[model samples]
Target: MSKVRIYTIAKELGIDNAEMLSILDDLGVSYKSVSSTIEEDTVELIKGIIAEGGSRAAQSGAGASTEAEAAQTSQTQTPQPQTQVQPEQVAQAPATAAPAADSGMTAEELAELAALEAEEAAEQAATAARAELPHRAPVVTIMGHVDHGKTSLLDYIRSSKVAAKEAGGITQHVGAFEAQTSRGKVVFIDTPGHEAFTTIRARGANVADIAIIVIAADDSLMPQTREAIAHAQAAGVPMLVAINKVDLPQADPERVKADLTTINLVPEDYGGDVITVPVSARTGEGVEDLLEYISLTAELEDLRADPKGKFGGVIIESRVDKQAGVLATVMVQEGTLKVGDFLVVGENYGKVKAMTDSAGKRIKDAGPSTPVQILGFSEAPSSGELVASASNEHEARELVAQRQEQRRDEEEARKKPRLSLDDILGPLSEAHTVNLILRADTQGSLEAIQGILAKKETDDVKLNVMLAGIGAPTEGDVLLASTADATILCFSVVPSGAVKKAAENKEIDLKSYRIIYEMIDEVDRLIKGNLEPVYEEQYLGRAEVRMVIRHPKTGNIAGSYVTDGLFKRGAKARVTRGKEVVFEGTVAGLKRFKDDVREVRQGLECGINLDWDEVQEGDVIEASEMVEVEQ
Candidate 1:
């Protein structure tokens, strides 16, 4: 049966539209307006509520005449008077909005017209919401190669020694702080490097206004330097290159500028638009010119924000503090944030009980372009989570509930198995990951094998054929397979004596097939986790923790001495206490001599940070790296 519009139900019940809406709200039935349609079940439920003495301000159109008096009475009625409707009962509704039964139109058609009118009205309302306030400072993000003086540059700009606080004098995490420059106030985001910078740029969150690439004049362009420039290009933000460490004897600003030209970042001295400044973070040489250029860029960009706008910010960093609860450092992009205000962030809502500025000073409120730490979240919100303000606690709770429900629905959808190659290969799991290199005698054979591999790869277990070539197996193929730790799969191809010798020496698996079905069956078995591994772990170093030191900034770390070989950062680690393996994870961090180091040799003591933190004294931490070997 067709749904009945609200006006028709109101007319049949001998009540005004406003009174009908009041009953709907009191009954907790969601609705839009008089143009909205109600299901037959809902209509019966409403009637039952009214019959049971449901309370409303008015009934039978009483106490609502004055509100409807201003509406134009231009609608023609049909013989059925029950479908008659009055204007102004649905919040200044149009006069031509006759009930569905008399309007000779479907309920959907009426809703469409009402929605069109509402959209126009909403547009007008949005135009009126543009807030006017003081101008905002420009937020700058520093990005470049590691150890290229990104943190050092910020240190010089803020007149603070931030790098000295880090483990290896390298920024390990993303952070933002405001600075007072000669050209007005500016905010700087000291990120871990271009990786974090790219992550922040990839997010739609409004964060950075300018990107400053710190290039060491001595080191010139590094791999990460080009990567940082590429990220800045993709982000579409204006950039300035800070040729750092110019005070050194080997500093060559001209060479740096020449190298930058190859990447389209031509310097101003080269008659290009890109600006470059030679500066030393240590000596503070040419630093004033850099700040002046930043101010000039901000002025040219005309950065401004409305402090009274709807509160919105992006969480740049968040961590669980041992004392102050969850501390979330947020970059305020728009509007104002103050203590006692409720904020909703990704299924989590928190009342801001306190705020601290960049300088670690307490602040009452923060405006746009301000970085403030928010305390009071029961749990730490994720980085890059967007913040939304609510008028009160009730609204914030409602929003959180809605977001949580949505997240659960999304998770349920994700839990379903994806339709991919798994249908052919039974079911693929993470343990079934296989890497192969396809070598075939003919192009057609190569494509056929590739087709089989590409038919349907699963996310859990993927069939990665690094290279597909139509040729006999060669020494190069063996070398590549040895390097990538992959198996060589051959279809109608033979290997020479040299290639075989090389494969035997390197222990690279070589599977040759004369028939396609035989190959497919073997591949199915291989991808199903039946293949033997061609790589083995080579022990790098072993360390015994003699002491455990606790610190407020770095957390719990093991003070250990390398006994056998050496310990390396990012190497696969296994922590063993006596005979039981307590933790099997990567070495997250390693430090020696109060500085971060990549590797430490034997008979030397260093600090080890593992993913598993319950490390105790006398625990043996073994570091290992993967190496290709016989299957």
Candidate 2:
């Protein structure tokens, strides 16, 4: 190699090129001074120096031998311009060269030359790997409704047991877990069963490779179930249905299958191949079958990872661990990860100090299909961030700095002033529009709300229900609404305190209502002033207090007239003392005197009895109405 190439190699090896000159000095290699341009003879001499184990004396011997070879070769034949030499002539020249001086190079020199070449090659490999590494994971989030056993199914899958869990078990932070099976491993993110996942869903991350939808066999297909299916379909992932609680006495698998058919999940029982596993998590039944199904599906899809490259993965979740410091559960999609490897995850970079598998076992390294908790990140990485490993700390820091600059530039771009509607569309254009994100407690409620709002669509002021789902309002949903400059309409589902605060800070309108029609009516009114708000209160049937025929002194029966709404026969009934429950008890009887009744409707009176002895005049008796209002 020439002196310039040697300097390049030295710099790459983190050695000062000045030191290379010093080594040449001790080698006694006679050469034009440092300021002179590198000659072909000098290049050969340097190669000889490297071949002789890079020692000063050995380099001098190799340089002397190279000079001797050049002298003898020049006498025998004129030195041709190597750059223009034909391949055949170059090959022949090497074969006919004077061997004595060339062979004088020592084993140490040869080894040193090979070492430098290997180092340069390794650096090139690392640079290529870094360029190829992907920075994010395929975030897979679960969605469904309350009481539909969504959490139960996830808990069963995560814990490998379902009996020891509580009702509505997932009550707090949205957790992420990695499940390994025969086919491969998958990271399951248990997002809050709220509209937040929908927003994440809309972002196109937090969607699954396959959506495992849980629906109760006994309950059949519910509105929430349909909404979950819709969201999954919208996300465009293959879906499998887990018909849960099959151990229940009233569980009807056929009914659920029939119900699912309407929603396009035609079950095998009905002659379609859409896999529906009848599972009873409480009994640990069909869990193995479910795993097998997942494996088979993955095989068919050919899910694969290029494990030969630099490490790249997605951050399933991240949190500050008391002992481990900032920990992140990352699904390694490619390459190997070891302790002390510098990693750049999103805007953060760190030297990995330790790693643990999903089971919390200490591991020295992790590869593809492995889900491991990584320690030593500079900061907590956001969920869904893509992580990559660098060859050194400096490179890692540079990569992070570049990413930060790119993000800053993006933010600045978004802040750049934009032309107004009048500038784009002209002041003569007469058009108005409203965008809304609709969320509800149940699928039925969402459908009802959507149906009501769909009626208000028009040419000028269009009511765009940008996104709708069945769940509580989540921070992601709030963020999405803020980004879209849209209003949120929540029906029945409560908004979390954090989401409420975010909404307030963002100045986004979050309207919540218990009645479906009222929600629709208000949306209609906002979207179009011509559409008067039509409120309809729903009466969900009624129940009565029968046999109040046994009043003693006052000769007054204390039975209830359930003009509307449902009344559980023995549920606590309160006399409304200005919205306060004064009288609450079991209904002693429900009847029209000579007969017993399960429920009483509006404009109907039923005889009932109270356990209390007190009866007074001017006391108004009103039955609670199960009303849900909609436009």
Candidate 3:
């Protein structure tokens, strides 16, 4: 019989070679070499060692006789050992568990147990992948007043020296980008800092891990800046102040820091741990340090994401590009996203045909913390929308439909009017039923309007401002008002052309006033039915009296030069004699020769008939549209 080596037994047992050797050593097996083979006799001896409860004495004098017999039998036809056990290992085999007295376990039971263990192991791996992905990114949104260098700062960061030469400058589209540093990566969202961006930021901040509030060092903190800080706080994300424009001569970092401290963002240099970096987007100074700090913060927070799970991301911004059709900047939050993967962004779903980074370079796949512009969406999604990818196109479509239904439900809930204090109280009370949909040009205006309206509530007619936000009035506002039977009010905000048309069609009564007090007063009067339509008069081209034709009964027909303003048939006419008013009456008829006309332009001669007066030579007729005053 040939000797079977320990290696052979270890290989058969599915255990490591080293562990097999360790087991032999513990059993006090005498071996000539590591490579020594175990023969038939050796197998019998090892089985004896096992039966002896792994005792070192089991291989002594008494076992030597049994071993000799086994060696003799080995020379003939090999006898099957009583138990198939390797040398130097004496323990009850895991496969041979004690069975119940009534029945013994079958081979199928062992195989079933192994299968169950394998399934559990697979489940654990999947669970670990899910557990590793971070829920959100350190979303740093650039914000400040309009034209205050918010976009410029973002451009500087994107075009940093570390960026590849092939990478273009900061993308105009609002999406997130990763600034890679020596330590780690920091994600920065390029958002508009104007009042319109507030809505964008509020949505972005919802999933933010951190916020970077960019303030011009020269200007300190403006009203919008304060509002941004409050928004970041309200989102519950830690903030890092980036005092930009440090290269400018008027830049005052210290003053900016002082101003920020009042808002509770004390700089680290000012004895506070809140990181404040003095940067110059123009000079590209201190950007590295800023990125390093951001990376360090992220490291401390242990940001990580699972690349083996389902993909989820956020839509930074979306727009219809002339060339690309619809483009979206998506910040991938988790899992691997590859080209051709089916994805659903809000209510839209599509197979990803192309993926591009902020620099517009096409890529095959994007992992966690990657901000890529994805192509092939079924439709363009709105900014700040949540996106997720499924296993296949069908799943993606189903998910999109589910999301659309959910959004419809949410919108319906928002449109449902609630009972205000005025609704609960009698109309005789001082409270006025002020129902308005407020829009503003800036966040400050929106906040101010909401604050004032909130405070002006009364027991009888409480201010029932339906919605207040920063941006031009949208069609959604018009539709919401039309459904809720509410009026739309705008403060320093222009209604979009579509919204204007919708408002007119719905008779929703859209009002825009610049003065805050005037707006409040108009709303107050409107609730009380004391408000009326206000109009302004406009001047049209006028005509000079050229030739007169007397009529028997009708007024005298005067031929005149159509000059300066438009001549309306029923407009009030004033005959001015060298800046002195001579006659005041309505223009009964206006015509070019025998043709009766509603208006005539300058340099054209026209015949005009007055209601109760006659025109003289060199008479200057001033035409004006009369407007009624509102009380």
Clashes of each: 2, 27, 23
Please, what are the lDDT tens digits per residue for candidate 3 over residues 1-631?
5667665565555554555556577767655333344566655655565556446565576789989998888867775545422222222234445542233543344445556777999999987875566643455666665556778888787767335645355344436666666654667776644333344433442445667778888898875676556445544566667888898899898998888776556665565657787888788888776675565455445567777777877777777888877777887777888998887866668888888886557789988777888778757887667777788978877887888899898879769967764454444424345557778888788878777777655455566665566777776566556544678888887887888998898789998988998887876666545222345776665667766778777767777887685788988788887788888888888777778888777777787888544568788888888575653
Better of 1 and 2 by TM-score: 2
* Residue-wise C-alpha lDDT for candidate 2, range 1-631, written one tens digit per residue: 4444444444444544455566667866543322223455765565666656557777789899999999999967975543333333333443332332344534444445556777999999987865464432233445555686777777777776222223455322225556655434555666534354455443334435667778787887765666566556545666778888899999998898887786556775576657788888677688777765665455434455556677776666678867757877776767888889988877778888888765555789877656678778868977666778899989988998999999999878779957774554434435566778788888788787777676778766677666677788767667666646678899888898898998998789998998777887787677654332344433244433433456565344655556565544443444434444456554554566568766556667765444555433223334343332443
Candidate 1 wrongly placed segments (more than 4 Å) = 1-133, 160-174, 409-631
Best by TM-score: 2
Instruction: Please write out the lDDT profile of model 1 over residues 356-445, one tens digit for every residue.
Output: 877666789999998888897898987667889999999999998999899898878779856655544444333455767777888788
TM-score for all models, in order of appearance? 0.45, 0.48, 0.46
Q: Candidate 3 has what TM-score?
A: 0.46
In Å, residue 11's CA in model 1 sits off its true spot by 70
Identify the runs in model 3 with alpha carbons over 4 angstroms from their true place.
1-137, 167-174, 194-207, 268-273, 321-324, 403-631
Ranking according to TM-score, highest score first: 2, 3, 1
Candidate 1 clashes between residue pairs 3 or more apart in a chain or in different chains: 168-596, 421-456
Mind sharing the TM-score for model 2? 0.48
